[model samples]
Target: MNAPITACYPDPGTARPLTGLYLDHALPDRGRHGPFIYANYIASLDGRISVPADTGGQGVPESIANARDWRLFQELAGQADLLLSSGRYLRDLEAGTAQDSLPIGIDDAFSDIRAWRVRHGLAPQPDVAVLSAGLDFAVPRRLLDQGRRVIVITGESVPDSRVQAHERAGTEVIVLPNVARPGGAALVTALQALAYRRIYTVAGPFVLHTLLSANLLDSLFLTTVHRLIGGQPFASLCEGDLLAETGDFQLASMHLDAHGPGGCTQTFSRYDRTPGP
Candidate 1:
């Protein structure tokens, strides 16, 4: 049981091509509100997005991170106007624990995406917006060398000195008037004002939970690898206590690839937010 992906849910016919599956989506046009926000995640059958790594940091289990999923992941990143991330990622980079770079379309594997960005009149790499209330990480020098516009978003309680530090590095720092946590509406309003129409969040689950809680997420792309990973100290796609009202998403598309690591299979699905004001 090993073959390329085939469309299943809405329509079924020829084996759909794997590449450009996500890239074909007109993400920027669907933003009637602030921005069309989306996130990409690959999980195991048991819903494990990450497990304990040998280096003490959590990592995506290799068995669940097959190459096909990675291709779609890159495609998602390739279409973003800005990538929503966290300051903790910079801390991890300094600690030599970070997994991947913040920039997309740089490596030869996806160099074509950079060209595609140019063709579509977008920058080589999407700008990066780091969400943090602590404001305690140094922007890596290599990121600047790659020419990514790094914007820092922090709460009002943060010290002015911290904001200036990032500004001094030519990194624009946005200090929102949020104390406990920047709820979904405030954050999206700020992003929308900047004219960022396509927001792709690659940050951890906390950010996704924040967006979903506010019903601000527009799309969710998930790849479920047909494998079970059960272990202590693992993480899932969304985390936190049960929400007052769980978010609802209607499936937009689904595809099945009969090949995964060790003869397993994978299901790639996309869900759109139910229409609401």
Candidate 2:
């Protein structure tokens, strides 16, 4: 209900709250993890993250809504440490598109990532780590060419042949146990081992759900657009018993776009508001 938030994001019938919500009971304090991990996403009013045909470009059915969505989207991307994602999102999003491919014969394209890392006192290029059962050769190649580290976390059953080739190419291919929990654990542990303390997981419902259910999400950033984007299938997390347990969550800081469109960007934040038993 902040003035600036409504003014910057004044779309009616929308849930564009200035400050969103954060729900976590694992950590006893705000900065519990050596470095906190932020899980971010954008959902429709009806809780959909995708369109019916999977052709809505990037989930927004309305132009204005898309603009607002991208504003927050870019902001989060600009501030994240390691952009962690799963192989499925890469394939579905065609993340292998050569549009930003290495910027061959040019040093210009690498500047952004380089500068961001330096500004944050991190490596020149943040690692673009993928959680996969095997190497995503096509995507990793492009990321590597852009000065980004291509790390593939796989399982024991991953084909031996591909693993060998990827390692030879200087890609960090980690093979973990064949269990589901171990996969994520291996990923977090490996990133930590490689000095990647702050990680950002941006992906589809399944990946997000896993982190949330595992109580690994330290923070969540979301952009709630103002529209009815029905038809898209979504994995709803706001249901019945889920609602009661989620109330322990709290809001930290609120940032209403001081100067911008009448649409506000809320940072629904909550630290360790309640003491853990």
Give the TM-score of each candidate. 0.93, 0.66
Candidate 1 residues 127-164, lDDT tens each? 88888887888888887777888888877778889888
Q: What's the lDDT for residue 158 in model 2? A: 72
* TM-score of model 2 vs. true structure: 0.66
What tens-digit string does per-residue lDDT give for candidate 2 at 134-166? 455545455667677777777776778978887
Question: What are the RMSDs of all candidates, in order?
Answer: 2.1, 7.5
Which window of 10 residues has the lowest lDDT sum in candidate 1?
24-33
Model 1 earns a TM-score of 0.93
